[model samples]
Target: MSAPERIPPRGVTTDEPLAGLLTHGELTVRGRIREASNAALYCTVAHEGREAACVYKPVAGERPLWDFPDGNLARREVAAYEVSEATGWGLVPPTVLREGPYGEGMVQLWIEVTTEGDTAELLALVDGEEPEPGWKAIGFADVGDDRTALLVHADDERLRRLAVLDAVINNADRKGGHLLPTAEGRLYGIDHGVTFNTENKLRTLLWGWAGEPLTPEALEVLKGLQDALGAEGALAGRLSALITGAELDATRARVAVLLETGRHPEPSGEWPAIPWPPV
Candidate 1:
């Protein structure tokens, strides 16, 4: 897709105005998905003739509310995707970000794909244990012609380049379970709540190619991203909306470092080697 003329609504971070999804009245506790975090509720709803799986993250509150909490995560994720969009890396599209009664929320296009649900299955697959039919491997390490690739896999080098984009973004949640395999062999990445950390949380299995050279095209894309996202321009302004000043600063520093080095940073000097919730 060509660069979008407008940045997504979710790209903004203020909570004063919420996206008028659901209703003005208090959000009722819709039936929940069995596998989402307690802090969030996953439900299916009808939106414009399509079934949507939306995560309702209530603001940090005393009573349970059906809204987004910590609007920053959604904002940062949207901005991250906005920056990534210029590079044409299709790992994760910048879906909609909106505000809700309790907190800020996001709406994203869902891809139908088969997933195994955890890193152990991924490890087993790497170890030769086969999954049920139709569940193909698509992650960071799964691409390219190297055996020591990181724990993830995708069908081709394009996805691998997107994986590199994700790495530079410091995506803390690059778990095997989060990688989705579509029937077309394209891998769709998900769950970016813990990115843009200032502390350099690089915990990911995609680091299998840490020391390898980035493809020329990938390098050009990164440069493009750096150019579009000025040192203190759109990206910085956008990230400041979703993350703490410190976290945003850290993310910018990390991006700057990646642009300068053209490689993922090693988690040295007391920085954590992995991120929490590796899945």
Candidate 2:
């Protein structure tokens, strides 16, 4: 069957019933998303006359990672969604774990977005030593040859919230291509398979706000997550099922440190701060 004509829910942005559409629906693989490193199937999920587009990445098709344990990326994707919902940021697209044609894997509602650049509308590679007024500098990038370009991201609140989310999840890869900005103005982040590690693996293109104080709104959300991810806390209970106990504790500790610092984190200098093939 062809992919669904209509898009599905945007994770926590919509009502709860849409999750039902993704969770229990019949999934049909229509095509393969070739750009993804793993086997990402473009599919349509339908249930009780409700149908929407989604992506299914089976565990069997996943490439083994040296750092992360094999066969657990699906759960981490769902865990990322859970944390996104917890923050009330709705950064991740709605995701769930279920059995698919290739075996159990992660299924996420496919978010329809505008045709922008290689990444989202929030990032730009401009020729300058400093970012303009509306943009925040993310350091310089070696474009090619011997020339370098100044990398800057828009000074937007949504991206800031996602930066915080990345820190909380310890997201190892937040490339420009991972950003999804809809025509309607809402932004979503995807490809969370390499997240929630126990180590400080936060790497991304959204480092424009580094060392800046967290927004008041962001601090309030983090305050809520601190409680939700505590021992015996509701978020912690759910995460325990998806990630290892050590990873969960690491997640909690990351949140605590963010709250204590009250600012965006600076790079540790021990690890490569930016991802390769950045976009």
Leading candidate by lDDT: 2
In the range 199-277, model 1's lDDT, one tens digit per residue, is: 4556664544565567788778776666555655665566566667766566556656766786645546475454444
- The total of clashing pairs for model 1 equals 11
Instruction: Pick the TM-score winner.
Output: 2
Error of 1 at 73 (Å): 3.1
Per-residue lDDT of 1-279 in model 2, one digit per residue for the tens?
564445444554566667887889899999999999999999999887778889999988989999997338899999999999988878898898999889999999888775742243588889989998989888898889999999989998888899999999999999888888876677899999999888888898888889999989989998999999988789999998899999998999998999999999888888888898888
TM-scores of the candidates in the order shown: 0.64, 0.94
Q: How does residue 274 of candidate 1 score in lDDT?
A: 42
Error of 1 at 250 (Å): 2.8
| Model 1 segments more than 4 A misplaced | 1-30, 44-53, 60-71, 115-159, 231-233, 267-279
